[model samples]
Target chain A: MRLRLLCCGAALLLLAACSSTPDESLYSDGSGQLGGPPGPISPDGTIGSADLNGGQPAPGTQEDLELTVGDRVFFDYDSTVLSPVATETLDRQGAWLKQFGSIVITVEGHTDERGTREYNLALGDRRATAVKNYLVALNIAPERILTISYGEERPADPGNDETAWSNNRRAVTVVTTVN
Target chain B: MTLPRSPRARWLPALAWLAACLVLPRAAGAVVELDITEGVVEPVPIAITEFHGQTPAEQKFGRDLADVVTADLARSGLFRPLDRRAFIQSPAELIDLPRFADWRQINAEALVTGVITGGEGGTELAVEFRLWDVFAGNQMRGQRLSGTPDQWRRIAHKIADTIYARLTGEKGYFDSRIVYVAETGPTTDRVKRLAIMDQDGANHEFLTDGGDLVLTPRFHPDGNSLGFMVFRQPVPQVYKYDLLTGREARLGDFGGMTFAPRFSPDGRWLAMSQAENGNSDVYLLDLDSGRKRRLTDHPAIDTSAAFAPDGERLVFNSDRAGSPQLYTMRPDGGDVQRISFNGGNYGSPTWSPRGDLIAFTKITGGVFHIGVMKTDGSDERLLTESQLDEAPTFAPNGRVILFTRKDYRDNHIRLYTVDIAGGQVQELPTPLDASDPDWSPLRP
Candidate 1:
């Protein structure tokens, strides 16, 4: 009865908008690309989801690397070239990865929302590569590191100003198992 | 229930979105030549009489359809739909002929009248729309668009498009769809989902959940498939999604991040950008051969590739010459000609459907502009300027460009359409922040 009235309300609307209501069949298990708004789903981030429990990490763990040595290295606007600060942070990341060799880590390159989506993605890829290469120069095994570019999509800082852009443009090392 | 749950029964119940053949009018109205790109011209005032129907329920239903047609024309910034309340007669009372003087008194130069028959069946509706020149007292445009009752909104757009094409020589962009990335949540951890809707922002539906990130959806030439980038399990990759079958096929595991997938004019190949070890280059994937061909081997960032309308050449953005600019090349990656030199960095170049121009995102003076240029990159003109305007997608008719507009004050992004000739701006209302709008070809 409620759906029928909602359908009637849709008839009164400017266009046929009853279909805008959530239809159950369009929601799927992500196996098929059924397109519909699935509400309130937890964000599937590479780093957060890989955490086995909701608890804090023990000492000297990858989470500790993020907490202590810093797992991210920032970049300039449209520049993939790492700064001295970035290399130093990456040097710490390399040491952390060397100590913890069992679990593979993914380097997520991100960017500010200043550029186009495709361009920022490539820019992020370059930033990730710089971090990987800087650590590889430290004699870190290249095979242990995988790089993914989130572009401006997964921004560390969502603000539009320079402060946010500075924080947003960085390469994050996420300890993960590729969910 | 609920119109058969689209994707399972999108547009048509069976078969593909291909082979959509338009029924040309019997007698062509002189295509009204309005050089709208130049100076301001007053909008043509038109009266949209409520579509007459048999029953009370049907009459209200018919009125709703007229409202859609009315809004579609009004949003074009070319038509001024008159107040329906001023009509001397409800359409149901005067069935055969409309009183011309009644409309003329309201200064309605054109009169639109429609009829809806057998709409309640929820299966098929017999819809007819007639566009009459109020001064000439003759029928200028008439079309019978019979569609499912569920498709009343689209049928209304079809009628509006028919009148638009008859009144102006250009093809109509109404009766079209826009696939975009819908955003919610906070600025830092925004959930971007794939959403689809009509060009008028009605009949909306989200195509994907927020579980994964989706971006930059480009429609197939047939309008049945989509090529979009998704950050799913394994890593970020591009996938070609078939709207007809709801089948998602990952383009490839190119051993790196793949972004920006655009279909060729012939729908034969998808040109995309791949980044491996920080080096980005353009690559083409053959749809049938299941093979990949390298189009650019530059050490510089070479990405965001789209095909020209003729299918003979490809236009893309590259920073090989020290700054990002637009360039065109043959499919084999030869004949590399530098095209953009208007003193701004250029990226995201999309060729117009008319094959005469290309629209791109230009960053100059700390502001981004959606600019268009000739195929050879001459007569460059900026359409809209904002804090940030990126990813300009041409309307199927090639007369308007829809793009992303990021507001500086709020940092909230929205979708807006500008005239191809830089005439007007219309902000599309979405439920949440939206960006990366790709307009689909005219629906069947």
Candidate 2:
């Protein structure tokens, strides 16, 4: 009787995996393109239920740099200096880069909508460079890292308060390619 | 030239005596000279009558043209167009001769009269306008504009520019175009496109599809091309879009990101910021030679470089002093002097066309303000205060500034215009949410 119960549980797990596989593939292929149309879910009532952690990538794939390792590092107001927390995050990212030797990454610097657009662009550039520098110091190849500054154009949070501002001032590490 | 001393020219001798007194050194107790340095700050009251037209099509064009001129003048804040209801003379009556006495009774300091006629083949338009100084009792300006019927609006703006220049003794910015970023969607995943429109927000059209992220559309001094940045995933680069041909090309072959592009005063070179290995610096790219020269090599972030009107110097924002601040330097990036000292961060410093002041965005105590100061950092005046105001672009005449203001509640960004003297803040109407507006030099 115990063996039959175990077999039943295994079948249910397989069914769940089979049902979610198509949605996972759709997101991984379609939504991975920056600024592309979002993926569509099946009408199986799994919308917003499976893998809804802020659209994080699945594990073990090259895009999973954002999921398995960390993807973002936060900065203080009008500052590009890497904090202790930011350094810790960069350390993990550097290790991930070392393990995935063929994967290339782009560090996008962003700022909260506080200062002028052009200045924030420069600030974002500084933050992104700071992240790249930290990763390089941790033995990541400089040639594998690219940096861009979006200034205050792209915000992680759409709020105006301090919490949203803190979340918006971030440097995101994106996996660009894998050979 | 000599004119007969008729009753109409009766003020000639008095004006001559006044001119003589102004040109000659003053003697003791000479003519009781009055030193008048201050003038009226109120809007100059003017009346713009509906233009008289011969044919039906001409009439429609005339009415539309006159309405556009009226709106343009009213938006300047320096001119107060009297209501049409209060007009004492009709367009037909004013075609023969303006009733200056009637206009003066309505408190109109100036009067405008025009006549429109459909040209041969009904494809061309001929517009004639006369500007009369009502109090002075003289025709200040008279001109004719002929163009295709589709260009009726341009003809109207030309007339307004004439009147504006005559009365204010300054160049007009009405006959100009504004290139800006039109935004839509939520703040998190906003779609932005390059859009161009008349200075008064007419004839709006998108120059690009919202395929990739676009920002900071700046018009070249020639007014026929635009420079902006486009983001294509991992890289963003500056691009030049030719208005006449609708052709686009990358400004440089940089390996990394290049942004915040502005043309030189002569439209011969582009000043932009380039980022590599995480450090961004200002660079000047020669359009003719395809040569790139790094302007600033600071460890801190240095970008947003704008050439002065004379092209001998540049004003840019830098964080070398720990926070973003306005700085001015020679074109080759020497003699750097910090031009902002307020207890806040200053950024996006754009030199005025008149070369008297530099407009900038300032952030202090979590509030953003649009402010102006002399090139040497004196007479700092903040013209606007809000939760987020930035990217101030000066009008061609330097009497006004257009900037972006973000509503703190909804994070919706809109374009606003404020007078340099700082009184009323006027919101520019845009079909979509707009930001990063750059006013073109007065177009011919």
Candidate 3:
């Protein structure tokens, strides 16, 4: 007990010299961009101030593609089979891609958060490939289209309701580059 | 009957201490033998006093070390640490002779006390701790660890490991690491980077820059490298991240998208799911020779393959039987047998280190559950049920499972751990929302 009190006295005297910050580098690399994308989306789905043009068809722009051609196609639960609505949307997308032959497009397939992540990833890959296959069948060059699966990582709606899940289970066609 | 020896025979430090017991005077009572076979239905009450230190730096480190040790023991749910305020004996008193009556008054069955010395100037740090069986009035285990001051936390973990092993008669998992995907932002544009930390969620560091999305960070059997899927270029490919040098290298050059990479138990080969022509199949890549071997040729999806501890067989999930189910086959992909006969789908089959049960995710009627079953899939037991709970990784001891639980109501995902014997489920604290956690092998 006396030794304990003596040690406490020493600790008090050494407290001033013992002030040292924890090694921050051990917890973080300091290079990580620790948050999500900036700029909030408007109610109409346009991000930030990009909607000032009143949804006008500005040529060769992301907004223009959304205006001229639909950028997404929805899928049913656990099914990669294209619906009539999806096919019709892809038909227009195929025609748009042919008109802009220099544009390279990526089909990102997504799934609801119900399944396992890896299986959802594989399902998303199939969904995106199904869309790409339809576009290729519509006379669009196969080399112009690429496919990636976001699995359930990227969702259109963060809610857990059926409506949010249905909205999340869709294939989005994004223009990668316009040559 | 003789006690079962650990397969690895890595308990030399404890054995050496026991050897010293032969020359010391025996206590009046027999050493307390704790039978942990029933698996901690009631946590053993333990008391850990603040360690004594010669200097201020040593004093602060001693307190922090005891805190970590207490947290580690408490996290396992096998030991409940008594509050420091209830302590009757001080550290100095405990060092010479713990007042057994005082400890028994607090109902502490076990007690831990330690001292830290040196580490003043250029001298190395020395930490010595003793585990006492309070009721037995005997020292159960004692050991001294010497390392640099920066490794104080690791020494504390070693102390925890020693105490846990002595009581449970099984290896402890305190001295381990976890690699998981750190998640941020909204659901749509979530930024994920491969991050690693101590098993207790300290000393975290992100391995990736978050420029590209990373998923399913799996540790190699050697524990020096990681295998994960990265969305680079237009396709998702498997990449290897070396923990020692922080070098990233793509695993294979395939015409298809590859994901869900897992290392073989021997760390010689990598198994992953590759998708071509809209169909995904399991493939193995030989790491040394860079040769590819197709493991499954079914039309349905075959992925999330894990090797048995012996490295002779594999357990994977396949949809070939109409819906996804767990299947086991030879390492060469022959003699396939479906093991999951339940109505729901079973995915993400991770073979336990004990080589007895396979842990998996079962989705039935839209609710996800983490479960384990026999190797032949006979005795199935679901351990947890939630709106979304998947990706179960076993502790090195194979007694506890760490998994991700998603609260759909709040869309918040966090890591949770539960003992296989089904007690209280504990949520592991992390700096950010995390998922796809893979526990590393026991530290060397």
Candidate 4:
């Protein structure tokens, strides 16, 4: 018991230290024109938030795709139907994949903590399939894409509130090919 | 008769019962019918005396046996084991003659007395106990179990099971084992390994090394094997674990993500869910023929299949009707009937070994609950409410349920067992975090 408490304390310290650093999901548009993730509220309106990231992410990289065209689409609770915004994100993703034709991708489906493991696994699979189908309709080769469901296992946001859950219920397009 | 000679044998005493000298004078009205529906059951006050012994080691074993047996019966929630500090009649005095007056004076309705005799060190230990109904002034049960001293705890469980059976008229679940996924690390990158322990949370051993993530372990009816899911390179697949050999092999080539594996009650078939192209369906793998048959072809999640004790019907979880709910079908997947109709989403349905109840996880109002209902879907009773409680497995006797609870307090997932009536919940101990519990049948 003492050891477990000590480990928990150590983990808390690690979490405290890690939270200060920006995670990969903190996307910043190179021009900083968009108000979505990391920007639009520059303190003096002189420096674009992209300056915080030093420079634009390299083209054809995961960061580049995440910044240039979005790499994730969110889902509603217990749903696989793609919202219009999700489709817009997938369409951009499809065009990016066409640009980088040789790069293979894996679509990872995820869910919130509200469901059981087995059912959420299936639900996440369906969500991934939904994104994959949308991209396939745009003529992306099915052979270049793989889908895996993480269920609620890997949450993008660890918080349990509705806002956290909305972010967690998502399909993430990951660059699986070696550069 | 030859006894199983392996020192690691799980139940030498249970086997010893085959040749045990039995004497149970079941007096009229002695069997107490447990009011399982009540939230607070008036526990039967029972006094247990340390077994009498001649040698110093024997005396210690006697004391340890009493402690173990008392714990087992007390955890059942049907008996209130009297504090040993309050016993007026000493161990020697009780063994000489259990004075019913002394027992009744302490408000004890039942008295248990025993004596231990054994060889030294590596030999056998023979223990015997008698249950006396202090109210009726008659003996309720008497039995003897002999085993190696290493098997002392098993012997104690056997004695407790026998006493519980005599008093409650239902089979006892004490002398059983549980296989579950022992968990560690953060929820984002959890490490889960297959683990086993006594039902009372002793003698814990991890079967797998945690290199692969394991989930939902279900023991075969023979208690020698388990079927569970493992996440390997390509996808998650159902795998069978041989308890005796510590060997594991994939159950089938489902060609997709397969999980939620459960052994049919008869151990001849393994049912699991296989998802292909986002459509998850239930399939049965015949153990004898090495063939797989699809039970449900719906484009919804249909999984968590468990067979009734008689092996005629299977109760499973499904979302084909839009939301997750409990459903029952024949073993051949015909006669599908929807069983859960409440507003909440229900999943992880497991049929009781007694063929009377189906236990499941109900998600209502954002809180997960473990609940039970009759096989016909009536008389639903929720047993627990927590931030996250899923995948309930009934005890061997079907009187108790074991499930996993994600403790928001500690950010830990642990195993817990509650009575079917929803009282006396216990956090079963493990060396590490745990989840996805599966109780094994009584050792043969």
**Full-model lDDT, candidate 4:** 0.82
Which pairs clash in the backbone of model 3?
Answer: A27-B204
Q: What DockQ does model 2 achieve?
A: 0.60
Q: B403 in model 2: Cα distance from truth in Å? A: 0.8
Instruction: Output per-candidate TM-scores for chain A, rounded to 2 decimals.
Output: 0.65, 0.69, 0.70, 0.71
* Cα-based lDDT at residue B102, candidate 3: 97
Give one digit per residue, the lDDT tens place, for model 1 in B1-444.
122336646545421111123333434443233445454567788888899888776787688899998999988877889988888978876567788888779988888887778768574577666777787676776667675667777778888887778666678889889999999988878898888888998878888878888888999998888999988777788998777777788987777778899999999999998888899999999988868899999999999999988898899988888778999999999999999988978989999998999999999877899999998999999888888999999998988889999888887889999887567788999989999999999976
* lDDT string, candidate 3, A1-179, tens digits: 99877755554443322233333322211212111222223566422234333323345655545545567787887779898767867887887887788998889999998889998888898899999999999999988888888889899887888878888888888889888
Model 4 chain A poorest 10 in a row by lDDT: A26-35
Write the residue-wise lDDT of candidate 2 on A1-179 in tens digits: 99877755654554455445343322221223222222233457343424232243444354455444557878888888787767766777888888888878888899998887776777788888898889888988888888888889899888878878888888999888777
Q: Which of candidates 3 and 4 reaches a greater TM-score?
A: 4
- Among these predicted structures, which one has the highest DockQ? 2
Considering only chain B, report the TM-score of model 1. Answer: 0.92
Candidate 2 vs candidate 4, lDDT winner: 4
Off-target runs (Cα >4 Å) in candidate 4 are A1-56, B1-15, B18-20, B24-40
Residue A133, candidate 3: how far off, in angstroms? Answer: 2.8
Model 1 Cα shift for residue A176 (angstroms):
4.2
Clashing pairs in 2: none
Clashing pairs in 4: none
Q: What does DockQ come to for candidate 4?
A: 0.48
